[model samples]
Target: MNGNVEVVVVGGGYGGVTAANRLARRDGVSVTLVNPRPEFVSRIRLHQLVTGSDDAVEGFGEVLGGDVRLVVDTATRIDAAGRRVSLAGGGTLSYDYLVYAVGSGAADPGVPGVPGAAEFAHWVSDFEGAGRLRSALDTASASASVTVVGSGPTGLETAAELAEAGREVTLVCGRVLGPSLHARVRRPVARRLAELGVTVLEGAGARVTEVTRDAVQLDDGRSLPSAVTVWTAGFRVPDLAARSGLRTDADGRLLTDTTPTSVDDERIVAAGDAAVMPDHPFRMSCQAAVQLGPAAADTIRRRIAGKTPAPVRMFFAGQSLSLGRNEGVTQFSYPNDKVNALSISGRTGAGVKEIACRFTLNKLVSGARKASSRGSHGDSGNRLETPQPEHPTTPHGTRRSA
Candidate 1:
């Protein structure tokens, strides 16, 4: 171990991995990544995993850069003042800088009367949850009625997949599909859902009051008899930032400026869903994750090299939606959230989405390979040499959103 290592990254998701890999390319900085899991879950494809369309889960070894050291442990607490991180076991990791890339998770709707919801409701956000949902679907009868709550992308994707599988699907959305999308874009989505045999229920403020074994009751006195209910309403950040006394947003997301550094501590940085970048408070998506990861790494590099960091830029070429197999909708949008005139749907849109997914995977793989090559060249000049204690102590009570 060479000591003088400059940065430590928490989490091993899209953003964390990308940032760590980029930082590793710098000659004078060592990057250490801490994550609970050994593999990276392709969260974007989780819907396909749940629908039994795809079973391959990509591993981190295939994507992590060599120069970045992978620590297989959960970050239990962040000691900002001391520039140290306490792991789950009993040791401590000290660093000159830290990046919080812990992601977000589905927000539990505090609806009353929903029985066994926490235990029964299926979500497509993570790998384990997707596996559970897939198993339930396979066991369900052909005539079973599956109710999907939330009209966002995840909900729409889930409904489309089930419908395509020849199952009865009811999409219960408080609003229409792509509520953020323009009316023109929304019309095509509705038509596609209808064509897929998915019953779209809109304006039905179906505030789930309770989730029973066989039905979901809405605030409007209607009971939707469903064999399964999937929730995809909203997301919440991890509570680690708030518990560590760092400034955060109302929903517990770490508050950062355009540079993506923690509001309270310049030594700490954040990205992905866990960060609330004031200048770009866009919705949490893989798109934002991909951009912010590299941006965060660049900022850390600039700071370490005593250079001024550049402002973060927000851009949106378009938004794409997948509707099972080779059918989807792609809507172009401006930087200011304006819906542009270009819209593509059906097979062409699906093709575009497929290309996008492949592009992301390719970038990740390429970055990891570069990182690994750098590590094998006997390069620890930028790497920290401090030997982390074997039995690391995990900080208690840090809540994670996702």
Candidate 2:
């Protein structure tokens, strides 16, 4: 409305990066992205990073907008009243609008016998944890046993990666494997894990009661010999929002409306796993985060222009699971994320999964390039072209974070 509109995006994950890039497109808008690292963490591939298949990181230049200021620092607090963000690196950033996308990290339920076990257990929750797990796996004996807990995509991918690496692997599904998948779609996943030589245990009895240095005690009074225990059970969002007095869900995800604007403040918006859009929430998957990113960005733009932002339109295309480096499975699903009988497996399936990963990186880079030209020449009124799904029926996992 006046001078340059300052927008500060807290977090460098998929949602934050997308929002920053989109905001950079508007004339007279200044975008600053705050993250702990200069490089973007491709969280979807952290499992591959842990197995030495990929590094899972790239410089901001690869995806972030050229005009966007990159602040390599963690956000310690958000002052909504003052419209400033306190950083871990000892500074504060004032903003006209704040986009919160702090994201999540690994969590230990603190079950008995697991007080200081993070140091010992292999974890793939973050880059550092993935690195540690890589080192542990590299030095462990060939005969060492590895147990991966949780039946979510993360746990499934981790167990498959190690098993494909020829390690002795067991996937402990607390209740069932691929709980979100339809029984028909889950069938192929089970078959592939079997082919990979992974031991899959279902039922509550398979739940880990305690994690020791070299073993995981199951609920059924059984101690599994786990030379390396990789915990991919679940994720927990950062508490920065709740602590800042912002409205948040029970899990600490910022509570937002359809437009992803914070329920308590119109000047603040949120996206990614850290945002809980009431009744419209999806799992903490990259598929959902990417859409939320651009949607939240548009919300900020509209608000600044004295207009109401439209509801964020999110469609979950499908589930892409890489069983290993060479083989995988792509279970096609509806836009609602419900699985279908049609699917792809083996090398062909791996190809689709790899494309999904590349599409995300490419989307960010493309978004940045468009933002650069548009900001320089003024608004061209062209809609940003997002990648469409290959099959009209198969939902496309177009973009997002890990």
Candidate 3:
């Protein structure tokens, strides 16, 4: 608090946390993290949360590295040229560098007269929405009809979970299920859906034009009666970046270079769903966010040290989809969007998805611990010459060891 911090990371999602931890571990840097939420919500598990399988929230104190100071406040504006950020709590923070990892929100399709859609359609994209969806599911009758809009992973997962829980589920897809999947993978996925008792409507081009308490109207002049509706069509970035005069895509995502730095200002960096890397913008997924986090941190570290940052290497690790508690699909993709010959599904696939989720959380925790340990040692070394007072350290000391 005495001097200007070296780096300020805005947002507390996967990308923001990773960048903050990595930056704080560097030899000569101070890191401050800003976000409205005090906890990190595991968005990937949101589907499961809606199905009452897992709690989606985790405490920030348990996740953030010791070296990183947490500021629980919304970022209102960015003064990139001045290296300062305005917080909603009437406080301003200045930094030598800034990272923007503010994520995206569910996109609203511009269908006319979609009454009650915003108020009734439940989305699993965020924790609050998921909680509401879960509560509604609990109150829904045993034979209640559940309609899911969108064919992506979230929609499929929600549909399958409801079906597995004994609720009648109908999945409405504008295109074929798993539109991005290869035909070979799509067939098995469809089969799995059938086995789970989920009615799959394909190529319906059914756009939800209106939502009533018990029914939804589609563009094709069809009405589907349902007790609940879940929407997972697409996502849109927050308007913070655009309103701050940063260069953004038509969808309001901050435009960044390959290294994840804002094209308009190198001092401003972005990651997660809020950033669109112009040279090689990949789909907005947790997979990309995890990689982008450390990549952004490295770029900032290099710049602060006056060294040229290395170019980012974008790679598609793979895609994993969960059908429910005991079924899933894992499609491996090559670096050039080529589908791998091998695909996993069913019980084995569920195991794989579970492992992947655990791996992601474990990676975050491990990275944070490493950063915290490094910071503590560095601090101890600095204070070695000034202190002579001795006190017994408690088991839960201020300093944490890996």
Candidate 4:
């Protein structure tokens, strides 16, 4: 753990960016972030991107630490034995430690076994997918019918955004709308969607059995005309970890211990949606990514100093849903992430959702600027504004949280 430490952070998403910034605050640490795109994508705004609300992209220079190197390339493989990362653009970078944060994206459309789902349905999960969806919408008739499959946060937001844009929309909820929210919150959300003129098909027999170029078939023998079908059913992580022969859960998430270190290699750690904390697994949302980012960095910083890495501590507050630009819903949950009776809706909820999105970007910028604070004040205790080990808790599972 000697002269200087070379840390290569794969994936420039929320977790990788925050981890790079925090790690760069310490002296004698060279942080290089490898990502396929040069700009930082604000994934939460992807739904907005589809409806021409927000482009959902920012320059890495605005959010990344000035000292951190940004490599615009995809990671092909991780050579753990050689401590090297092979890039898709050619050449390999050597690293003393690796941070795996290659976040998740839309799951395979073929997974549901619905015909034409993969070829016909559009997605809004990733940057390129959102752009493709936008292009498809732009070319399609404005009066054309739009159908959104799945009722997660993404589906709800996308359907609402499209409906507000004056698109004839139908929401085919696979099972229930806002399945993770408390019954109290779900009621308000359904009301808002109804007000937006969203045709919500819930309860049994609402699941889509087939997706065609012009319509969708339901399990209950119903055919809905869909000029443009959007599929946001599920998400899957990149196969880079599995491809590298690293230990991963069945979902292809990198398996880590309490300290967030890879069970196979001490020099490797994980964060974001790609990481699975078996003991305290949480959802795949920005909430978890921002917190886990600094914790992963803390682990690396401790190891570099020849100290034991501390265990990661995390919790959840609630779920935020933006039903178009004027209305929304916020469902409060216990620290354990169980939906409680507490809830908020209408304009107040919209304000909360907007503030949360703004705060996410601000948090990254603040973390990047912390390097100067380190020089002025020296490494202070818990410099990163990440969640601390105050009250460690776990969540039920993944659910929609915008």
Instruction: Point to the candidate with the largest lDDT.
Output: 4
How many residue pairs in model 3 have overlapping backbones?
0
Candidate 1 per-residue lDDT over residues 1-402, each given as its tens digit: 234556889988888989998888878787888877767778878888877787636766667775666666777789899888887655677788898999877766443336667666888777777788888888989899999988888888888888988889988887566676777888888988999999887775656767777788777988898998888888876788888888888888999989988889988878699989766687788888888889899888888777888877767777887888869988888875567767899999899878888888899988877776754755322221223465343323322111
Each prediction's TM-score versus the true structure: 0.90, 0.90, 0.90, 0.92
Give stretches of model 1 more than 4 Å off: 1-3, 111-116, 377-390, 393-402
What C-alpha lDDT, on a 0 to 100 scale, does residue 181 get in candidate 3?
81
Q: Model 4: residues >4 Å from true position, as ranges?
A: 372-402
Clashing pairs for predicted structure model 2, backbone only: 317-395
lDDT of 3 at 143: 86
Distance from true position, residue 369, model 1, in Å?
2.6
- Residue 275, model 4: Cα distance from true site in angstroms: 1.2
Which candidate leads the pack in TM-score? 4
**Residue 21 deviation, candidate 4, in Å?**
0.3
lDDT of 2 by residue, 228-276 (tens): 8888877888899988999888788999999989999988999799989
Descending-TM-score candidate ranking: 4, 2, 1, 3
Give the Cα error of residue 230 in candidate 3, in Å: 0.6
Give each model's whole-structure lDDT.
Answer: 0.78, 0.82, 0.79, 0.86
Worst lDDT 10-window in candidate 4: 392-401
The sequence of per-residue lDDT tens digits that candidate 4 reaches over residues 1-402 is 778899989998999999999998999997888888868999999999999889999777667776676766788899999998887755577889999999999988888688899989999999999999999999999999999999999999999999999999999997788788887788999999999999999999999888999999999999999989999988999999999999999989999998899999989988799989888888899989998999999999999999999999888898898999999888898887777989889999999999989999999988877753545443222121111123211112222111
